[model samples]
Target: MNDMRIVERDVDTNEVKIAARDVQVFYGDNHAIKDVSVDIDDKTVTAFIGPSGCGKSTFLRCINRMNDTIDVCRVKGDIRIDSEDIYDPKVDPVQLRAKVGMVFQKPNPFPKSIYDNVAYGPRIHGLARSKADLDDIVEKSLRRGAIWDEVKDRLHAPGTGLSGGQQQRLCIARAVATEPEVLLMDEPCSALDPIATAQVEELIDELRKNYSVVIVTHSMQQAARVSQKTAFFHLGHLVEYGETGTIFTNPVDPRTESYITGRIG
Candidate 1:
């Protein structure tokens, strides 16, 4: 790994939304991530693609401080969102999470009514002044999640009762209800059928218009389809980062080329 050449290119012309520098993660002395650095652009979809256990998801968790929940996980380095250090002692992880919403690999919706699931964040954050405002937020968020039409009539129904794809979309709506600036998805489509995955991919494209979308995906095809920027990780190192097309077609690093060509994973 030490002899591997790493190539990083800043191809996105959009405004930078998140900047990570010299980031490292350790789980009880097990170094899960190395010195990874990258600039994520606002209103753009950036995909993290690598083999299993390549630290893509771990690094994703660091953006929202989700790793802090684990007893042995430790993160070191500077991660800034809109120029604000997310790891600063003064920053509240709960509040920081509101700004950086995450959707996990599975469609894990709270065991509550659909309306309540989407309303949970807004209520806790005091984002709504009244029932009417909360209702508006829920509707807008569901619409953004592209599941409003399917669930509008059954808002009082249980969220978990929905199909896997609908449940995922509902979870996305719940994440968006708080008006998060960045949306983090950890292999969101891995559990869905091809059609549902396409729907979610389309929704991701729509979402990039408003939020900085960072997705950790094992599927290179999905990464190529949905993201404008792509980062290739291998053995805890970011081997290459650039425009998605460039990373796929003309990677500067041999490791990235090998991974892209199915010679290595």
Candidate 2:
């Protein structure tokens, strides 16, 4: 697959990013995520992989408080962005989301034109002061998402009219338009073809130059292809986490080895 493997950051890089400590999640009476802790280095892509219902997605949602949308879901433990506690009561979820953007498995675009889709975040967050500024933001985000050339000719076309892959790229542009420091993606390529998946994967690699990216996927190969680090979860617990190359080639946990070898999910 892709050869852009992850490398450990320099201690003096001056770009430390998100850190999670004893993070846990619960859905009403059922605990979904066990105590988990990990660091997401700046300008890196960290992939989460595990069996279904193993809390990979749940933990991802916790990063940006997406679980708040579920009435019964509750997140516990500490999540910090650059040493600031994101779970603080004074933290505004809306503003936090702008700082830590997310792209879901399904492409949920606004019922608006492609241009508007990319411009929506900047508009709502007051990041652009004028039409020209908004246009610039939209163009930059689309380019960063690697879909600008393809859709540049039809900026006014409805976002829903694009192909599935294109729609997802539009969604990515929308998320990055706000200039988020972190990008969380949940199975972003689950709906795209191989060619489209490769395009998106390449975009993910490029995005790490500006923001820390976290992804949850079922495909072990995809995790190996796109992430510098890989985290494996089992039965709501983080079973193993380390460099992607090391995890795939020499997993320290038996559960991880079993899962990677196709002996268990």
Candidate 3:
């Protein structure tokens, strides 16, 4: 195993928090991912952009071992988080998820109070010692998610009672409450209005100050606005990966250019 260290860009700047090498996935007879590889940096946002069925989301699931739930799914290759292989048999998915939480495309809040939504992770992971600790975690997480002040007075309200944007924020709070080192989001803004989308985007920007964030998005403009690095996937292969500015302005691969220019999917 290679000693995975951050690929530094300058004297004081380090890039890449997670390194994936020769990663591939197969669902029975169908190969869902090819030999895809890339580096994700700490405290930065990396956006995966491509057409539908390009395996962006599939690859994202591999980071936190979400694909393990599927009985037919088979994954091969090495994915290291801070130089530790996350796929080792001894590595528990539950614990891995605690370190690398995820927010799905849909706003899926449990049938519980908004406070419980944020407190759920700490409770399950035993992160809090007492009621006061749990309460503190819930409040802090909600605030970090940018919805605490709005719901501070009514913590007991059902999470589903909130609007789509608010529910999504609640999901984000739940994820952050786990104190995850990496946060994975799959099309977080796909279901919100323009205003709500902007709000979530801003929250995502703020999130990058503390955790490495990987987002799979179909919106090229969104990727350009929120991500420092961008990786383009096409038909299960990572076509190109580089600085977001370079990828958008001058992509190295023809497939990437074609997709960006509306020439092909």
Arranged by lDDT with the best first, the candidates are: 1, 3, 2
Task: Please provide, for model 2 over 85-121, each residue's C-alpha lDDT reduced to its tens digit, 9 standing for 90 to 100.
Answer: 9999999999999999999899988899999999989
Using all chains and alpha carbons, the TM-scores for the candidates as numbered come to 0.95, 0.95, 0.95
Tens digit of per-residue lDDT, candidate 1, span 5-47: 2233434478899999999999998999999999999999999
Write one digit per residue (lDDT tens) for candidate 3, span 9-40: 22114666899999999989889999998988
- The parts of candidate 2 lying over 4 Å away from their true place are 1-15
State the TM-score for model 3. Answer: 0.95
Shift of residue 55 alpha carbon in model 2, Å: 0.3
Cα deviation at 110, candidate 1, in Å, is 0.6
State each model's C-alpha RMSD to the native. Answer: 4.5, 2.2, 5.4
Worst 10 residues of 1 by lDDT: 1-10
